[model samples]
Target: MASAAITLAAEAPKLSSANTGFMLIASALVLIMTPGLAFFYGGMVRVKSTLNMLMMSFISMGIVTILWVLYGFSLAFGTNNSLIGWDSDWFGLRKIGLTELWPGYTIPIFVFMIFQMMFAIITPALISGALADRVKFSAWALFVALWLTVVYVPIAHWVWGADGWAFKLGVIDFAGGTAVHINAGAGALGVILVIGKRVGFKKDPMRPHSLPLVMLGAGLLWFGWFGFNAGSWLGNDDGVGALMFVNTQVATAAAMLAWLAYEKIRHGAFTTLGAASGAVAGLVAITPSGGAVSPIGAIAVGAIAGVACAAAVGLKYKFGFDDSLDVVGVHMVGGIIGSLLIGFFATGKGQSTATGVFYGDHSFTQLWKQCAGVGAVLAYSLIASAVLAFLLDKTIGMRVTEDEEISGIDQAEHAETAYDFSGAGGGVVGTAVSALAGAESKKVDA
Candidate 1:
């Protein structure tokens, strides 16, 4: 009877329908973030470049999805060679058994693949904010392909793969402060250096065209982020997923308040843009630490990141690099701050056991490990992204013509505009009566 029972237990399916259902919902939530990003970036640009900004993000969704299916999943999560991964079975997401589970986890291999696919989709979309209003749509798309192949995939393996160096070294990235945010931020810096700034960058106002849209995007991103952060655990068998969810909310709230405070003191008002950007800054910072830190630590992480990112955004003007939308300031800096804080704030409680400077035996072991992972990803992504951008710039040309820059990127590149201006001599709404009069005087317009 004992032998028969052992055999039956061994043969029972490892798949967890509960976990699978959780991941599917999580994947759908993460997918919405790209459109949220589109609205966020879309609202930041002038009306002239609105569609171009949005398409830059939307194109990444299209491009990365194809690449992930073809070779991205295999190369990123397959058998690790320390620096990268490969497995022909996962090539084109093929040949795995219908019920095959992902090694140690109860979820099916396909569920894991799709969840990670959402990550690949948004990482490139994040970089588009840095290049807004200037880049050719085709060049940006091609660069997304190249950058994914070279930079994002490898870093993801390094930070998350079972046998990768960072993972083996005990680097504790609960989600993706290193793999996603830092990688995207450094990559943005590289491309901007190669492509240069938007025309009349510092001279032009370039304020976000629609704060309401930015707020909507921020709301969507915040909503989607629960899946992005909590779902990283891949299952709710343990209670870590709940902890991560709470931390995400805590840190994000602290960050929003901290940012508003900073701007109120420095810029003399609490700006909506500051609130939105701050919340995201908190999200980016806590992403790596949420699974490990207590909620109090989460507040510290969020507040620090919010204030730091707010200050860092102004550094572009002081240093004279056009990050268009402060990708480097918020993402890069926020990721770094969150990662390094792990060295000090880690309590050795949850998903990761490595305690930080403030906890454990007070040793810096985990801190050093975090530093190694952060530096490696940041340096590699920056250098490789710059090379890709340079090659694309030299070959197909990255920026639209100067005429396009002044005329409007939407019409120049996409041949479409965000709003209609065909009121025939109305110009820009002289008055309610004048607008009606002009419409009546002119032929009907589309």
Candidate 2:
């Protein structure tokens, strides 16, 4: 997410209690999305892989937090005029004062760092959805550490840093359309190319173990997104934050309805999975465009993203790639849809002065700028992530053994089950009892 305009120069900005309190809340909201992501992903995998899926996302929080404190913040927002940022003062978050405002914003430097850190934490976690059910937990953790350093930090600086090239070129990103969603989505595609598909790709149904959990996670994401989108403006000093807050709701609701409509027409039913996925797709789309478009424009963006992602999710089956939970389909495709549409939908009056292709005088320059931003991130993440995954796969191995996967990755990897069946009928060990109970727990992932 980009910060609100920084007008305060050498005359240091004073802290606003309201903005600080609001930002802290926003930071907390963004942090919760990781666990929300865990539940969302956890419920989508088969019974055997649920715990492993949750752990994949949860581990990112632990890994990225430490990295962010140490040097992730410095590299990502260090205010250097280059592709990467570096600040000696921000090293280990030392040499900065408690009351020191972030450049021109009224919030504390820690508040801004923590908010951005949540984005860092969640970006890598988003890739875990594609790696579900088949990866080694240790290898996956290692990839998160490496990928954050190699891919996320530089791109974050490129897009959001005050001195970064994309920011200088005037590529508009209200939140994280390019930096977070596209980065993770591309990384997901790259990693999956190396790890290959789940054990049974087209043969098994491989449905979700818990739709209720998916719905719960989706709801939590929706609630937290108000802060995620609104807080990007950095303050309620102007009504832009309020506009973003409403756009988030409007776009998400529209996307859900549009997706249900598409599902019913294409598949003849409105499934819970479609609703959950559709909501997330809208959130991804608006993340970049919300600050630049109107409420009506947000509806268009959301509806288009909903239908596009709904259609995109089915592409893996036709193309033969095993995106286990459609991370590429939803996030990658949805992010592209949102980021590019800014060229067409921007009103010239929102966050910045840039005009869209559809506005009066019809400037197509922003569209080209958006392409530059999107293409750079997509190419860098795809290549960098693929290299990282290849190194890990060749050395320590990325996937589990076929025997371990078939038996259950939970026991093979984490040594525990997501849902215990031992007490189902005096014991869930027998084939008949296990099969009956497991049958009741089954649902589809796509």
Candidate 3:
């Protein structure tokens, strides 16, 4: 009877239907963030370059998806070595069965693959904000392909892969503080250095063309982030998932308020742009710390990140580097804040048995590990991205011609415009009605 029972227990499947469903839903939610990013970046640029901005993000979704299926996933997640993963047998997911569990998880291997793919898609898109309105579409696309192969896949392996050095070194990145945000932020700075600034950067009034659109994008990004932060647990039954979900909300709200407070104190008035940027800063800061920090700790992380990123954005102007949309400020700086603070705020009971300096551990061991992860990823991404951008600039040209940039990237590159101000609706009466109604003109130089 004992032998029969043991055999039956061994025969039971490891897969859990409920967890699989949850992961499927989470993957879809995360997929929506790329389009949300398109809108977020599109509205932040001038109207004349809106389509170009949108395309820069949208194209990444397509490019990264294909790369993930072909070799990106295998290289990042497969088991080959400590620094990088070899294709082995999982190239193109070949021979991997759908029912096969992802190592120790309840979800199917395919489900895990798709979830990680969405992350790969958005990381490079984040860099488009820095090079907005100035890059050639083809060159940008090529850079995405090369950068993913060289920079992203290797960094992902180092941080998340089981045999990777960082993972073995006790570094704690619940989601992607170092792997995604810091990597992309550093890459953005590198690319902008090689590509140079926009034609009339400091001399021009480059305000956002549509604050409403930016708000809409920010809302979608916030909503999708619930899936991003919570789903990293790879299971729905874990109580930590709930904690992470709440932490995400608390931190984002706190960060938005802190940003406004800082802006009010420094600039004399709260701005819509500050609110949207603050929300994003909070999201980025809490991502890696959410599963480890308490709600109160999340507030501290968010507020610190908000103020730091807000101040960091201005440094570009002082230093003469034009990070058009402050990707370096919010993502890189926010990622560092979240990663390092975990050493001080981590509860030592959840996620991992690691406590921060503020949590009474006093050792500062975990904090040093976080610093190592952040510094390694930041340096690798910066150097690799700079090389890629320089090679592209020399061979195929990274920037648009001066005439094309000044005239408008949308028409010069894509031959399309985001808005039409031809007044084909009703001519003079429509114009007069719009004016009487206080409707802003589409032709206005936003």
Candidate 4:
């Protein structure tokens, strides 16, 4: 009996180590999706603000990385509170040093923390795309900092934290259907309402400068998404994780085909933008249900999401609210579609959990639960985002001067240009003059 027990104990450690290693790799894969987002948004904008839009996402990598290490992690995942997390002994990486805390897996708690950190960083950056080319850089930077602290941290705690109310309520968000997509989409609407439309939103053509760039961005996003969905499982289990991976790919492809077909029927030509947008719409929709639904269910979800998001994009024009980049239409609508559809598509085998409406367990209860969850997130995000935007607009001001906006923020704020072909270029000349004046002022002070 003693010899058998010793063998079992030895095997257990190996299994645990394998699980930890898988989680770490999956998390790293998710981190790469942020830069994919940067390229996607960058390609959608005009050349003048291409670099600015990309910078916004890159900056999050820096800001959120630091904040997560400090207290953001504590506020988000520390406790099971409804409102927010209290600073317990676990605050500021205290519990991280204790190896025993990483239960059920071999990897360190620190690895888990960093993996989640990437998601926290990228969500706000996605919202920034909706208000491109108008807001002051300093203000945008400050807004995300404050928003992450007050808004994101609390919501993440409510949804994914250890003792979160949403978790207790059994709300299913395998990835971030509500926490990331709906939250960012609602926040985009709030800020755009306060800042007003770009200078010539309706009047100017504002065509995308490069379709190829958009395609490149889309490819990256799709590639990185495997990590996003499968990584959520945080284990090497072939059952759930493998299902999620296949669902993600199928849905994306289905959405792409649907979008292109719709565009061809409606418009004269099948544009690349339609294909990329459709794929992303499907990806967003599948995120919430990837782990819960079957492959066939994923196809249905993607097809509906693609069509719905395509139609929803036009609402901005009809309603006269400037979403700028269609963040509300794609992310918000797709998220809702996935969240609700999962109710009808969920299934369970012999040892699995609950099944959905279509699996012979036809009932409205699951659908109703999904609706309630969607409504709660929409209401909370809309109100909180509006309040935050209003306060920021009243205090520091949300937009740049009209003249500064027309000139482009790169020149007005940073005093540099994104591209400079001329040797000792115009930007260099301008910088030299400004430096000379600053030196003169310093000499006077001395």
Candidate 5:
């Protein structure tokens, strides 16, 4: 009996191959989301600015990856203090061995690093949508580098880090509601205020050039989000990952339908753009709460986010802010809804142990905590991003010249065009028509 007891105690220390494989695949899935975001945002812009939109997202993948490898991972995941981490021993991953697991988790420390790296890459990419078609490429690149270091690194430490104040206060951000979506959303709003409106703003029509591409991008985002939401569990020991997976799907579907339904009632036309936007809204709302809410709860969250975000998008026009691609409306508003709803809908059975008011916890404590997380991140991102944009604007300038604005940004900035209007000099038909015209002119002259 004594020997059997000792063996059972030792078994828990062994690495889990199954969990490792799942996380490896999950990391790959999440990595693809950045390009998917590229396509999604790329298709939403006018054709003249398409490539710039795509590059903005793709560049974040490169920039954040290097930053994460150097010290970002350490600052985010290291244990040091309540507000932000300060351990440099794991810098460049020198201290962590490949064979060693992450603390008590089944996966290697490297696997966890790459998985989190994907999240860090996509967060700044999300902000690109709001600043499309206006800012200089160099300034934008610099902003990405600066924003990630000042705003993202610390907020991520606060929300997801081991000793983060939010984490210690019982706030439940299962994935990245406060850290990623809210942070990016508020950051976008701040920069938009500093940069001012796009030249056309509401005066000219800036319709999406390709609906098909938008749909394709949205499809990819939906597919990859499974890994993003479910894989946050870090392991599959208790089947909670499966629950998160189902919740993600159900919520997305519900939100898409809700958006379409609202469009039909208000606009009299159900648009493909509306559908794609609705799906993303649902995904954003469920991201933080998927592990805590039931499928029914997910449906409610999706429906609410779909309607709220759909309505919120129009606020740019009403309130007069140039959120070029609805990032403020969809991501910021949806993230807030998801984070706060946890106070009302949390079941306290899956990933988080805290129950909501509806679940019979009978207190507003969780709601207050959620508010703190959302408020702090939003306020900090807004002020910090504004200062960064203002400084860059005053020093190096942010916008292109007026002539560049009238001409397409592709030609003005990159010296290339997404579409070439120049045709072949002349085809066989053109040659025949020219010869006949010359014969007629000669006959008339004679």
Candidate 6:
């Protein structure tokens, strides 16, 4: 009887295997988003620095992927106190093999580590859009590496880790409204302040080189976002997972329609770029609230995000901050809208229990909490990012020379062009030397 029981137990399907498989697939979906971001930002930049813009995101994947495996995951998810994780014993994922600490499931710790690593990779890359076309690639790389160490890992630990201070404080970030979007948006502002605006900020026409690429990137982002939002469930549950899935779709669609409608009324045309941008804004808005809100709430969130982002994007002209790709407008404003609105919309007892000043909860407790979270994230990210950018600027220099700015970083720094239709014989190395020679000759002529 004992032998027969042991055989049956060995043959039975393991729950951990299923969880691990789902996590790995989800992680893969999320990883695709970095390249998706490449196309998204690439299309928005001038044709001259298209590849350089894309390279910023692509290289983040390479750099952060390695760092996450080495010590990032440990600092983020390791069993340590709240402020920051130590790399003493669990330096290279050594202790992860011994136990599965995440509750309610039995997946390998490595799977969870890899999944979170993807988030760490893309968050900083999102800021690259704001500083596009001017910053030196090497300096940008150094800045992100330091920023992740100083800013991202600690905040992630605070919000998501077991012993995190925010978790203890009951700051409910379902999937990184504060950690990812708010953090990236605030950081973008800091980096832009330090790096300065693009060469022709107000004057350059700076139209998207390819609307199709924008749409494609948007599609990929939308597809990957399902996993991003839904997989936060960390298990196959019908209630929260289903809610997240529906909310993600509703909010995105609503936002897209609202953006197009606004554009038609204001500009007399509904651009494909508007559609894509609206979808992204909606997705960002829904990300923090998808698990907590209902379908109707999602629709409202999406519509508001669409119109709000459209209006907010124009703030660059008014407030005069050159967020080159609308990072502050779409991400910062959209994040605030979603985070605050969720206070009113998260209903219960058929009466909106946690309602904002609107449906009771009149003390505005939830709204205050939401605002506090947003403010904290913004302040921390802004200060930390500014310090890191300053350090990099002082040590390695941030922006390229004005000559390099006009000539394009693809040829000057990377020595390669995004498109080589002219049958240029030289690769990136040759282009760099030629560009440098041109700069020197111009200096001599002057």
Give the Cα lDDT of each candidate: 0.90, 0.92, 0.91, 0.79, 0.90, 0.82
lDDT of 3 by residue, 314-375 (tens): 99999999999999999999999999999899997677778898888787899999999999
Those runs of model 5 whose alpha carbons end farther than 4 Å from true positions after fitting are 1-12, 423-446
Predicted candidate 5 versus true structure: per-residue lDDT over 99-190, tens digit per residue: 77887788898899999999999999999999888888888888898898898989999998889999988889989999999999999999
1-446 per-residue lDDT for model 2 (tens digits): 12333433335678999999999999999999989999999999888899999999999999999999999999999987769999999999989899888987899999999999999999999999998888999999999999999999999999999999999999898889999999999999999998898888999889998999999999988988888899999988978898899899999999999999999999999999999999999999999999889999999999999999999999999999999999999999989999999999998888987889888526589999999999999999999999999999999999999878877788899889876654666543566677876666463211
Question: What's the TM for model 3?
Answer: 0.95
Best of the candidates, TM-score: 3
Estimate the overall C-alpha local distance difference test score of candidate 6.
Answer: 0.82
3 or 5, which is superior by TM-score?
A: 3
Query: What are the per-residue Cα lDDT tens digits for candidate 6 across 289-374?
Result: 77767788889999999999999999888877789888888887888788778677766422123445555667767777787777
Looking at candidate 6, the ten consecutive residues that score lowest on lDDT are 348-357
Checking candidate 3 for backbone clashes, the offending pairs are: 343-356
Q: Estimate candidate 2's alpha-carbon lDDT, on a 0 to 1 scale.
A: 0.92
Ten-residue segment with the worst summed lDDT in candidate 3?
Answer: 437-446
Q: After superposition, which runs of candidate 3 have C-alpha atoms over 4 Å from their true positions?
A: 1-13, 427-429, 432-446
Instruction: For model 6, name the residue pairs that clash.
Output: 415-428
RMSD of each: 3.8, 4.7, 3.0, 6.6, 6.0, 5.7
Ordered from best to worst lDDT, the candidate numbers read: 2, 3, 1, 5, 6, 4
TM-score of every candidate: 0.94, 0.94, 0.95, 0.89, 0.93, 0.88
Greater lDDT among 2 and 4 belongs to: 2
Which of candidates 2 and 6 is the stronger one according to lDDT?
Answer: 2
Candidate 1 vs candidate 6, TM-score winner: 1
Q: Mark the regions of model 2 whose C-alpha exceeds 4 Å error after superposition.
A: 1-12, 425-446
The candidate with the higher TM-score, 1 or 4, is 1
